[model samples]
Target: MTVRIVVDRDKCQGYGQCVFEADDLFGLDESDTCVAAAEVGEDRRADAERAADVCPMQAITVE
Candidate 1:
């Protein structure tokens, strides 16, 4: 199984919170924008959820 990930660039503030929570699934580009894994193994679902929870801008979504 895999979890889908989406980061709303318009709403993202480049805070890196999501990256901190899930380094393997999230990252920041040179401009500090949120970059994310399009999909990840189900084993990483909890990490993805945590990243979503910590997103101050509420720009991260996991499904």
Candidate 2:
């Protein structure tokens, strides 16, 4: 199964907690807004989930 990471920009506060959990999958752009990879490999599913869990605004969705 292909893993995907989705961030709800409307709800995100750019706190960067997701970046700490999975820097390779998520990051803060020059504007300090939350940014994430659109998709990830199965091996990195856990990392994606962790990042989702840590998002303070609950703006992340893992699929």
Candidate 3:
């Protein structure tokens, strides 16, 4: 199944932790906001989950 990722921009601090944890699904933009690095796939679900886990702001949700 295709994964859905939601990042709460207001709660995010742009720390980039999610980017490192899930490079295939997360990134930091020029504005330092979190961005989707790529469309999420089943194989990348774990990475997405890890990103959610490590997000200090608790701003990421995956479904």
> Which one wins on TM-score?
1
Give me the runs in candidate 1 sitting further than 4 Å from their true place.
none
Poorest 10 consecutive residues by lDDT, candidate 1: 17-26
Model 3, runs deviating above 4 Å? 37-39
Model 2 TM-score, 2 decimals: 0.93
The TM-scores, one per candidate, come to 0.95, 0.93, 0.87
Give residue 56's lDDT in candidate 2 (0 to 100): 88
How close to the true structure is residue 1 of candidate 2, measured as C-alpha lDDT? Answer: 75
lDDT of 1: 0.92
lDDT (10s digit) by residue, model 1, range 1-63: 899999999999999989888788999999889989998999999999999999999999899
Task: Kindly list the per-residue Cα lDDT of model 3 for residues 23-62, writing each as its tens digit.
Answer: 7678787899998744577888888889999999999988
lDDT by residue for model 2 (1-63), tens = 779888999898899999999888998888888889998889999999988898889999999
Give all candidates' CA lDDT scores.
0.92, 0.90, 0.85
Say which prediction, candidate 1 or candidate 3, comes out ahead on TM-score: 1
RMSD of each: 0.7, 0.8, 1.4
lDDT (Cα) of model 3: 0.85
Give the clash count for each candidate. Answer: 0, 0, 0
In candidate 2, stretches whose alpha carbon ends up further than 4 angstroms from where it belongs are: none
Return the lDDT, model 1, position 53.
Answer: 97
